[model samples]
Target: MGVTRLVSRRRQDPGTKWARIAMAVLATVGVIDTGSITLKRWGFLGELTCPMGADGCDKVLNSSWGTLINGIPLSLVGLIAYISILLMTLMPLLPGLQENKADLSRRTWWGLFTLSTSMAAFSAVLLGLAVLKIQAFCFFCVLSASLSILLLVLSIVGGGWEDSGILAFRGVLLATVVLLGSLIWISAVDSGRSANVGEKVGVPPAVTNESSIAALALAEHLAVGGAVMYSAYWCPHCHEQKELFGKQASQQLIVVECATDGQNNQADLCRSKRLEGFPSWEINGEIDSGVKPLSILADLSGYQGSREF
Candidate 1:
């Protein structure tokens, strides 16, 4: 009777229900945050009105670190993580799980702790990259990191664990593993550091992709229409924009090197134009920033030869 009563009392102890509620709310916001970025990257949505300006967001998001090995947007990974956290937070509250609520709650709390720890660790890695390597301020990235840290904190405060030592051990182990894995993945995909070593100091990477006939025609048409691409040698998005045109087509386009140290630089003209971001396009005497799809560029340049690009 004593043992049974002890078990019952322990089970009935009121956990921090408020913390779970807060976690759910935060996770929902995270879902929307990451989801919007994913949609924009996939071209399902138009340009995002980032706080401060679009330049930082564009630089960070179009960098080589922005996508996974398979070319999927990194924001999609955050979206999936947020959705999983949301489901875990709300699952034990369902009416069907009421009979096993105590046990389910215990297990889910552990799951939340592990998952949130991994997220927070990985977020730290990304933050380091944004600060030290990418050297850009990404509002969405900062928001996601904040959310992950908060989720980890909530998991700890609300778990009501009996063994602090065990919790500490698990957290340390998981974080170390996550940090190591994140570093390895980042090093593998960082083209700025690895692939451009032999090139001149201020030269951009060579365009490796082949141009389609449609792409070639579009490029010629853009050149004939007096379209100009303004870019800095260090800008990843500029390289990305060139890659879209492929090697042959990219050579045909009028590319002005805006960086003072870049080869064949036109710094004075770029300053005269008051350029705000890399890879800005001057089409029909109108300046626009960010990387444009080939089809959009074709339209902007009044290219009638090829809609296939």
Candidate 2:
């Protein structure tokens, strides 16, 4: 066979083995992220409330980031990617056709390459937006980011690295498309429409009686209540927390980044703080986890902000 013909081989390279392990980890992350969001959205997980003691899960989920492109939950997207990674990584375990071994390897390589490259680039952008643009954290979002980062590493070290040149080039082209699309769409859209930079809109604060931007800024410093929020940038609920605080207010409270990639990284504080879940809160140091209603949260925290809890 000509060297250029790409030889018949198995994807079970030593590196592929490691990549498999990494994909397993990302898969687990997806499961955790999706599971949490499901519970929160369904009201099965409502242990924590906001400073106003309001429930804002639905509010945030209904927002933009919760879904991708047209209408796909970010969790579903991660689930698909991780599942794809799992399948591609485990391709070796599949029974090979009597005469299509080389074709199989090439196909698997191309698939894995495509999946990993797109996911990695997307994660990078989401993470950047989470901190610099949105200035908020979502445990699930960060979890996905970490998983994507791992997948990217696995793709590179895995045997697919050799086969990924074409995919990588394509990935760059696609990334350019995405970036340009975002720039164009954003430019065409309302500049005041909020650029994923978490900010306040809609209703004004009923509690503090002051929704002024300055008041919102002061609220952050006053304390975010005894709440432990487990969040990832990719998580809509976490963004809900930011929305509640009005972008500027969300920056004041202490946050934990459970996502291993340090997506928002309130300084590796989650582990040190023994944070157990995303969007979890410790009201007066008492643990009340998950997306919660502002009213209920206020009651729990003894909200004295002039808002009924």
Candidate 3:
């Protein structure tokens, strides 16, 4: 009777119960999302959509950040992380599980979950860059961001620290510190990826090329310097503009899509920027409607380039 009572008391630590379970559920979903992204990158999926338009999906997918070192999909890494976290959190429930449980854990679960949180946050930030800085969006990137936010919430809610002993608390506290320390690292690595690629980057350059510049002589009355294209994934006209640049050249143009429900969705962002229309352009920094030929756009901006637009 005495042994049973002691064992039950030891087993029912409050924080471990709820926090661990929540972590498993949220982390597991994150795994699935990340796993799919990895699989997609392996050429296993074969169809990556371009955030600007569907034309450049393959190009961006094949670009850098599509795979991890040694060709591992970053999504695969998320899967493994989620699976490991699930196992660690549920370990206390295993039959004779504590036999493997150390009296003072390095707090491996806490440390790992904390790491996962940081990675998720970093990924979400990069996704924003993919949209804003790069001016393109990845559907898979959105899915991953959602998963990360979900897991972070789970971790906070599942933590049973008040009921945990000093050792567990200390481990958690340390893990929190480590996660914070990594923010600078995430920011540094993520910014560059955000800056390059996508139509947003290509916009000015596309409008600046030769034939378009010559055409600008005709459109010079518009006083257009900067033109923005509001686009949607389903817009056929946007596809036409992207095609004008051919595959490689098109990706370099900066295109801002305005589809609220777009897979590369930036609902609040588009709203905040007051972006409207598919393949909409802001000529001379003033919003203009419809897809204009490259030459016409150049005239609006007074472009001077030797290359044929």
* Highest TM-score against the true fold, candidate: 1
Per-residue lDDT of model 2, residues 1-309, tens digit only: 646543224444665656666666676666666655655555567533323312233323434555555444565666666777777656654676526645665666567656776776777666665555444555556667777767666655564444446545676887676667655543443353345433433321222222445435334434745355555543455666656665455656565555443344553565465543457776666765566656566567565554421
lDDT, candidate 1, 1-309, per-residue tens: 343111111344445577788899999999999999999777677677778755567667877788876769999999999999999999887899899888888788888898999999999999999989767788999999999999999998888777777788889999999999999988887744566633675587788889989989988888888899999776777888999989899999989997666789898898788775678899999998878999899878877785666
- Root-mean-square deviation (CA) per prediction: 4.9, 10.4, 12.2
State every prediction's TM-score relative to the real structure. 0.79, 0.51, 0.46
Model 2 stretches astray by more than 4 angstroms: 1-12, 42-63, 68-72, 95-102, 160-168, 182-309
Residue-level lDDT tens digits of model 3 in 2-77? 4311011223556656666776776677766666556655435533443555423322233344445665555676
Better of 1 and 2 by lDDT: 1
What is the alpha-carbon lDDT of model 3 when measured against the actual structure? 0.53
